[model samples]
Target: MSTAGIGLGLTGFGVFFSFLGIILFFDKGLLAIGNILFISGVIMTIGIKSSLQFFMKPSNFKGTISFGIGFFFVIIGWPVIGMAAEAYGSLILFSGFWPTLSVFVQKTPVIGWVFQQPFIRSFLGYRGKRAPV
Candidate 1:
């Protein structure tokens, strides 16, 4: 299976667990499982750009940062912020997927506006731009 395929599959698992987490909020174990899967799915979907084609160089940097923040928040038992952080982190990570997504979906919606920033551009791995020297 392709990376995109794997990423999407993980995304499904993540969503499932996230709903499970919500339903079983009082149960720490199930909640933890849900939280972990959601974060993992987002990160994997982001494709860890730096690792892609070692010679190509990654244009993004903050995916790991947001991901860490989310992970930490979850560890500290802050369910709300942790999930929010994870969500933002995943969106941060999704920059790379934007170009391909654009081809399929046409409008990028709100993220289309956020995509204007230089930082967000990097996060998207500089999709459509020439490689740096």
Candidate 2:
């Protein structure tokens, strides 16, 4: 599960970076390079999953919901994905955005400060909230 989380996170970051790069850069040559890199990153990520296992896997409610969301995102984000691929190869690995964004929000200033607030931190802590044995 942890490995899957890491893989998904890397994929999300790759895709996000790729999108930012292509949109920010106008050089055709550079864009071509970014696209190639993005494709490579995607291929690497996908390689982590076994094809037979993927098809043969069973789905629970969580899996079904996740798959639905993913399918919807892919359908809606197709154009954005192209631009992302043209910008940064890392964008190819974008499934980890939620956790990455969470960590980023905690570390980066402005938005970061919001997530890092004392009250929020205390509320999120589980150390003292467990039920007595």
Candidate 3:
């Protein structure tokens, strides 16, 4: 399999483990593992150079710093706070991709139906805007 495919699997697992850790009363070990896997997966998927460039961009500084801080907090056993920080950082860092994600979700068979609902669409502020790739 290709590196990107492997990376995607790892990323999926990382997200799963992270959520599982949260569900299991904020387990520190699980969160740490999840964080490590997630970062490595991203690097592998995008390549080191692109990953560095993406993270080091001036516009992404705040998100990068926040994410770094969150990772540090997780390492120090502050799982709850670390997760909270990471969530905020993720939102900021990935805001640009939200439109693309929305489009994808809307195109899916099952999820699309739910996403098309008036209440859900309004809540998510999804006005069917197509993002430029």
Candidate 4:
């Protein structure tokens, strides 16, 4: 699939899990499942970024390891740490100003780059032989 396709899929997963989590709040077991799925979504995006980074720069061990650690943390923390982390982030942007700014920034190309900086241009290995640099 194309990069945009992968990114959009990840985004959909994140949204689905988050919404499910909200809907399941009243039911303890379902809530836990939703939380786990949410964590999985986060891990999925991190893995995609890491893979892309690997393709871009084979020697970028730091970036690879960073994503690996994030993946591990999200997996290990699912239903607890993951849920709390999401909650914290949501709370942080709960303000009217922050959400508005976030939307505005996302709409601006430069600002969007700022948000995607960590993963932007990171490579997903090409299907065939590597091209000459």
In TM-score terms, which candidate is top? 3
What tens digits encode model 1's per-residue C-alpha lDDT throughout 1-133?
A: 8766676777788677667775776343555676666545555665666335321334444655675677677667876777677778767766666567743332366665665566756665776563332
Descending-lDDT candidate ranking:
3, 1, 4, 2
Q: List the residue pairs that clash in candidate 1.
A: none
Give the best candidate by lDDT.
3
The per-prediction CA RMSD against the true structure, in angstroms, equals 8.4, 9.5, 1.9, 13.5
- Tens-place lDDT per residue, model 2, 27-118, is 33433444444344444555545533442355333443343343333435443444433223223233335455556567777876766666
Q: lDDT of each structure?
A: 0.61, 0.46, 0.87, 0.48
lDDT of 4 by residue, 1-133 (tens): 7545565566566557556755655333444444455445544655756645533464544444443443344455444454555455444323324545544654677766654343432332222332223
101, model 1: CA deviation in Å? 2.6
TM-score of each: 0.49, 0.32, 0.92, 0.32
Off by over 4 Å in 3: 127-133
* Candidate 2 runs further than 4 Å off: 1-25, 45-96, 104-133
Q: Residue 44: error of model 1 in Å? A: 8.3
lDDT of 3 by residue, 62-124 (tens): 999999999899899999899999998898898989978877887899988887787777778
**Residue clash pairs of candidate 3:** none
Q: Please give me the total number of clashing residue pairs in predicted model 4.
A: 1
Off by over 4 Å in 4: 2-11, 48-86, 89-101, 104-133
Task: Tell me the TM-score of model 2.
Answer: 0.32
- Positional deviation of residue 56's Cα in model 4 after best superposition, in angstroms: 23
